[model samples]
Target: MKKIIELKQVYKDYPLAGISQTVLHDINFEVVPGEFVAIVGPSGNGKSTLLNLLTGIDHPSSGQVIVNGAALQNLSNERLSLWRGANLGIVFQFFQLLPSLNLLQNVMLPMDFLGKLSKTQRRQQAMQLLERVGLADACHRLPSQVSGGQQQRAAIARALANDPPLIVADEPTGNLDAATADDVFDLFAHLRDQGKTLVMVTHNETLAAAASRKLEIRCGRIHADTPAVAG
Candidate 1:
């Protein structure tokens, strides 16, 4: 498998009250093509911070974050945005869809930014994704108009809009009911089977158990990295 992401001796810090506080420490990690990885830990253990580093949304205080063989720290903000837009898809627990855009428009936003496709092509592609997520009818609806589960499905479709090679979600199932969470996770599994690399931060051990690998974080450090047991 091709290595899609790598983090070497990475550390991240923030200034709090005139003091430097480290949230992540000496984190070394990697993900290969088509792997589904789960990140788990107690609250405030820095799982989200780790995810941000992988996506280039945040930079490490030291060390390197290389995705698709490019070091993220070497890019300017403008370049990083473009690279990330084309290479990574991010999903948030809160379903961070634009309030003003309808579901179809939200899914098209990434493609719109990329501008490699014509408007008609973008629309057609977005509609297909929305339909795949069982949101065909809701494509014209605003995020507030849909149920939480529906919103999350739409978020997944939007994540795929740019057709990124990697997808990362922080607490993807955190806000949904058990059945709904399962459905969302099924989407991730399906993506993994289709050769898209996925990394998700979740508290649900049940879902974590279904991933190809699991990483347990404790006190801002990786406590364990193991292959998840298959049922």
Candidate 2:
């Protein structure tokens, strides 16, 4: 496995009542290609803050963040967006599909923005991804028309639009039933087997434990980092 994401002595601070409060402290972490890493912690432990840094949605106040070999601190905002669009696939908890677009259109939107493929090619690629996620027949349906699990599956396919090596999922199964969440996790596992790195922030201990690597956070610090076996 090749190292694809790294954080060095990272810290995040936010202003509260005119005083700075650190939400993440001296974080040091790395994720290599194809590993499924679950970040688990209690509420208000900065799990989401860490995810933001990883995805370049938020920058660390101090220290370095490197993803896919580029130092994030150095990229201009425009460059960062370009880099993210090209290299990282981000999945969110709410299945952030455009409500007006059909599943196939939603999946193709990323590729369309990246403009790496022709119009017809984008449609074909998105169709293939939807098919892989078991949503070929649902492609024409709006996000509102599909079941929660199917919508999540479509979101995963959209994340794969650019065929990125690293995937960051923020509470991807937080809103689903147990069986439905299991189906989503199975898809994630399959993506892992296909050599796509996954960093997931999850509160579900059962789901987190199933990941190949687990990082436990407490009080904005790493409480434990360990390997785990998941069924």
Candidate 3:
């Protein structure tokens, strides 16, 4: 498989009390196309930071982040933002839906920003994504009107709005109950089957176990990198 995302000798630090504190050090990894990878670690171990770097939301202090063979460090903020919308999808623990927009409108938001599709075409694509996420009937519902699980599913639909090749999820199921989390996990599997590369931050061992590969982060470094076998 071809590499879709790569981090080469990456390091990130933050200034604390006038001293630099390392958050991620000497990180190097590659996410191949159509792979499902779960990054696991305790809280405050730079899991979120890693995701931010991968998505081009934050820059590494040193080294390079290459996505689809292009150096992310060289892109301007506006260009990076546009590139992310076109090539990368992001899902968050809190769902991050717009409270003012209904499910259909929220899913259409990304397409609106892209400005590459007609209004009717965008609506059709959004509805199709909602159907794919099993939220067809909830299209008219507000974020507050849906259950937690349903909201997360809607968020997934929105993330797929532009049909990105890579999806970066940070603790997507953190707020859901076990059963609901399992449903979301199934959706991830479905995406994998559809040839989308997934790099997810998850605390649930069972969920992580379902991935093709697992990575453990500790003390701002990769502690373990291993392939996981299905039971």
* Candidate 2, superposed: residue stretches over 4 Å from native: none
Give lDDT tens digits, candidate 3, residues 1-231.
Answer: 778988999999999999999999999998889888999989999999999998898999999999977799899999998898899889999999999999999999999999999999999999999999999999999999999999999999999999998899999999999999999989998887787888999998877887889989998899999996666
Assess each prediction's global lDDT (C-alpha) against the native: 0.92, 0.92, 0.93
- Backbone clash numbers for all candidates listed: 0, 0, 0
Cand. 3 Cα-lDDT: 0.93
RMSD of 3: 1.0
Which regions of candidate 3 fall more than 4 Å away from where they truly are?
none
What shift in Å separates residue 138 of candidate 3 from its native position after superposition? Answer: 1.1
TM-score of each: 0.97, 0.97, 0.97
lDDT of 2 by residue, 86-204 (tens): 99999999999999999999999989989989999999999999999999999999999999999999999999999998899999999999999999988987887887788999987
Q: Which residue pairs in model 3 clash with each other? A: none
Q: Please report, as a residue range, the 10-residue window in candidate 2 with the lowest summed lDDT.
A: 203-212
Global lDDT for candidate 1? 0.92
The CA root-mean-square deviation of candidate 2, after full C-alpha superposition on the true structure, stands at 1.2
